[model samples]
Target: MFTINNLLDIMVLVIFMNMQEKLTILADSAKYDASCSSSGSALKRHGDIGNTAYSGICHSFASDGRCISLLKILMTNCCIFDCKYCLNRKSNNIKRALFTPEEICEITINFYRRNYIEGLFLSSGIIKSPDYTMNLMIETISLLRHKYKFGGYIHAKAIPGASTYLLNKLGNLVDRLSANIELPTENGLKLLAPNKDTNKITKIMEYIKENKSQTFVPAGQSTQMIIGATKETDYEIMKRSSEMYHNYSLKRVFYSAYIPVNKDNLLPSLNLPPLKRENRLYQADWLMRFYHFKVNDLLNADNPNFNLLLDPKADWALRHLEEFPKEINTCSYNDLLKIPGIGVTSAKRIISSRKYFKISFNDLQKMGIVLKRAKYFIVCDGKYFVNNLCFNRSFIESNLVLEDNLLTSLKGEQLSLF
Candidate 1:
């Protein structure tokens, strides 16, 4: 026989417990999404609470090189589908939590004022159905914008198999959106995450494309594929990524190292995450996106995987020795980009500065080119810089050197948020 006052007291306790308990559980649950980076949004919403710029979001890098300061968390950790590799899969015995739409709005506003976060990166487990989960997230973002006037950046992941209408609604509100192609191929999804497929995932992207002509997803869409999860080759993954850029107009493709979170017969027992492979893939992606390199330019049947010892660009240069020792004086801008160690800024500097004065080896170093790496690939005016170094064989060990002046490079300065 509980009194009305007793019932109220019990309800109050449950609510308090939910706030702290759920925040921890849901935040930890959302950590698996590496595509939550909030950048490249040129949106300016009038009278909004937060603002999104190229680097307006804080660029606080983690010790592991991950950026932070976004209030990234899941709406719920209770899923209907059981993906074996997932820590929060239905079969896994774990603490579950849910954040109401109002609570998400409250947290974002409070965190913004306290300077604890610059924006929100919201994701969720498939609770009840994809529609239910996506709508809940959409509701959360709507409250942040309309009710709280939160003008801050928002990057949300679209749930696979979610309704097209719900998907369209979501694109209108957030600064950026992503649909995680968790596994590299359809076969990998069928074996592990049996319920999900690329077909359903691509439908959302297709819808976005149809709607993109309007103001939908103004910051553009991006995606992530978990590397080392399946038997898919680097060539296959890169081919798919290139197709996405040309086919769906994707802004970026993120590669996540497969960190084993659960034990399964389907998964390999690894000592550590394949971070080196992951880094190489990102460098390859950069070549495609920024360096004007094509998929075929980086890979073929003979060289399916990128060399772990050297970067993708340097590796390509080493393989094609005949192309090296490029005379910088007469090379076109496009050809300059092909040289190893030369980036967009350095290539531009060569073109621009050469018009005024003849480019030299020392001048290149001042222009932010890594002389140690570039010297092996370029001939300055008529004289070769590293002419003595043999390129007939792999110079991987001797040629290996890091460019410390990345921040001073023309491209580097352009990327700085502040």
Candidate 2:
């Protein structure tokens, strides 16, 4: 039964099984990564095989939360670093796969034509060394751009230890570049992803901003920070966000709520990631960029985080209640923005409509501004229209929560729709 030919036959079967297993493992592992979308650079075909569109396509998501489009597979699943949260961590006892640059290009081209995906995502697990892996990633982009003339949307991951030259070159070809901050703080990185250098990662982000101006990467750069994995306060996160926006001119900083994939003793064992915290951070970020609220105004040493119950802006208003009860008819647009229920859109509507005639409480209701919270903060035509009995802003804010649901449901109704 143990003949030489029989042994060779078993070995051949084993190799085939291993290859099949590797593909399944790597693709399944990649499903959890949600860093999708193409919005940075625009590449023209110039009589080449393919072309890039400004609005890139994202197909769908599996249960694990990865956006499924563009053949979202890693170049290799064999990592050198032992990031505890990563599925492909060096200590992971799982099947691994590595694709040659040509193989990846062939797959992308075929997939694009069949309408399976618009392009390629092409991330890796730090095979061999960071510098070497970075080169391979660049080489893959080079092959796709130069040899294949692939003008489709290509989103490439900037390898951690990759040189500036490699990043700048890769930036030229790909539509978007993301250098994941992984963890929020240096201590978090030290505990969760020991090998990662926080300083080096930040430097790469700055370099991306510096170079992307004159050449490609018009969409600018975006990075991801894992939340709830470490003890980093939301204040700390926003502080870094402030610097990142000011110094590097980053387009977005995404937050991936940390779901413990591995059962490490050091990690939390929550059934779901801190989605609420993630939502609040996005809200705060919107305020910073659009609402003209500074990070310092939102948090301080004593209050180094956001309130889970109330939004950041509402909470800020509660602490400083004396500024409320302003005249709605005469209040300027900038002043209207500070009112609890009135947003930029509503404030502009008030300013435009009131110029024709003085605005009353009835008129504000017709303009579609939420009045429950605005009542405590605004006066209509020299009349105290609302109860105003409860001076506490929190009581008014609590009642305002129902408006979002009511408005959302009324969107398709005949009264609102047509």
Candidate 3:
């Protein structure tokens, strides 16, 4: 009953099936890497295929909250290491795929022409050795740059313990380079991912900084740490992060919430990833980098965990009430930033405009300050705006969470003052 037409259809279907399977396995394997931010480059393009400038690349987040849309994939998932936390670890019976250098180049070009992706985030599971794997990566990126003339953004991962020669080679060819820190502390590494160590990771980071003049890495270097996989406290993890930034000059440290892929007795038994913890860390990180907050300012030995209900800044403001009720009109720029509702923009605006006139409560609202939380921490023209509202921490915390018709209530408070 079979005919030549039916035979053609079957062969075509088989090809699609095979490619689909490879894409599925490799893409799923890549989800564990949490180092995918691509916004740090400043390269301009003339007539190149794409640019990492103005419209460099726009990021789209996956369902689980990792950045996607850069053709994020691994060169191969057939890793030699048997790190129990990894799904692609050896000894696990799973289908594997490897994209030849030619195939990878063609896929990148095709995707770019179709506007499907603006760049590539190429990572790989170790095939032979770290140097061998790094060379394979170098070849793919080299082909994309030289042969295909790809001028778009690229985020390359530096294999830990790879030869410095190979690492420097790839660094010249990519916009961003990252080596995963894997775990925050040394004890965490020994317990969960025994094959990895922080010493090797830090050495690579140190090397990149030393060789930046010779290598490109224009976007600077970054690293990643898995949260909640071990017993390290948030304080400990952030303290290490702070050290890395000051010591190694890292641009960013990405925190990925741990998802238990395999049941190892050494791992925590969780039904879902700790996304909230990950988010709080990011908020705290932002405070550190931009808001001029020190790690000690955010967390200490006694208070290690972030409050789930309120953000770190709000929580800190609530605990350190003596620092609050700061006069908006005359407080120093540094003090203006400490209030929960006031951000960098609002703080700058207050500093700029207060020279002309005495700013009132309404002026703060117009400056994009979040008054719902700021009202508790700031005073306008020696007048407390939330004078009628409860000043206790519990009342403010509950009101902030419930929102509780608070904005309208505050408006009423304003009307009564007249």
Candidate 4:
């Protein structure tokens, strides 16, 4: 009762349904990774379909605060490794899906045409072996680049233990690449992910660093580390971050608060993700990256962890009271950055404005400085901004803590219906 055309149409419909199911499963699986932020690549080529400079891909954010400008997904959710912290581990009873190279290219081209995405962020769980998975990823990107002519921003995850040959091929095809270190400490990795090798991970990073030319990984490499899953201190984590920056030339080290996905005996029994700890680490990372603060300056063996009440800069300022009341007009640019409320922009503004005219306390406010926090630490025109200010550590500490609490309370308050 059916013609050949009728049977072919039915087959196409079934394939479309299957593709939709794969997308739903894989996209949800990819959400746990926070290292997919895209920037620093202005990749545009002749005869290409898209550009990274189109609409500022970094500006787009999902409702839950994750970057969603890219068609972020996995090649497959089937893995051979059974990591304790991973949701897609082999032992977990979750829905799995795989996208073939052609399917990935088709999806990316369609998404780009619809203006739903400006880029592609592709990662995967290990299938068969690391090399096999890397090969699949490479093939997908190759099809996107050559066949589809997708010149948009593409970020790919380099599988650790995959050969340098594949690593080089993948790096050349994508805008940026990341190889997640998984855990901060080697011991934590051993306890949580017994199959992963720290040496192999570093080797991938090393290879990327050594072979990086102008056309190869123009956005460079980044990595992610899980926090609160191990017993490592903040000092240890920052120390490793510093080393990676200097030793391997890493662009960023993203910190993900370990959200417990599996209930293994070794995993922590966390009721919720350690979001606050993760925030503090990001602040400290900013200090190390932009403010040029060393690990020892922010923390040490004596005071290893960050204070939950005070931010890293504020806590550091409180510890070194001798450096307080820094004359805003006379302090070095480096010292200007040490002030709690003054960020990189305001600090540069302070330096540039002072060259033309002496900056007053009123000018600081106009420059978008947080006067409440900065007032206690800075002086303008050789006079204290706060009249008759007490320099006592406890007094200043209590004031900053009170201000933070008030701000948080205000933010959490809901508007009443009249």
Q: Every model's Cα RMSD, please?
A: 5.7, 6.2, 7.5, 5.8
lDDT of 3 by residue, 1-418 (tens): 2111223543453355466677787778987777666666776533258767533455575654444658888887767777778887776677666677887788888888887776888998886678988999999999888888888878888888799999889998988888888888988887877777778788889988877652378788888899998988899989989988988789888888899988888989998778778888888888899888998998999999888667899888888877767999999998988888788888999999999989889987777767877887777998887674566788777877666346547665211100
CA lDDT, every model vs. true structure: 0.78, 0.75, 0.79, 0.83
What does the lDDT read for residue 362 in candidate 2?
Answer: 89
lDDT per residue (tens digit) for residues 133-209 in model 1: 89889988998889898888888889999988899899999877778778777888899898888899888888787
User: Clashes per prediction?
Assistant: 3, 1, 0, 0
Q: Candidate 3 has which clashing residue pairs, if any?
A: none
The runs of at least 3 residues in candidate 4 whose Cα sits more than 4 Å from the true structure, single-residue gaps closed, are 1-17, 54-56, 413-418
Model 4 poorest ten-residue lDDT run: 1-10
Q: Extract clashing residue pairs from model 2.
A: 40-219
C-alpha lDDT (0 to 100) for residue 18 of candidate 3: 61
Measured by TM-score, the strongest candidate is: 4
> What's the TM for model 1?
0.89
Q: Model 1: which residue pairs collide?
A: 49-151, 50-151, 50-152
TM-score on alpha carbons, each prediction: 0.89, 0.81, 0.89, 0.92
Looking at model 2, residue 279 earns an lDDT score of 75
lDDT of 4 by residue, 307-408 (tens): 978999999999998988799999999999999988898899889889888888888888777788988888898878656457678888999999888987
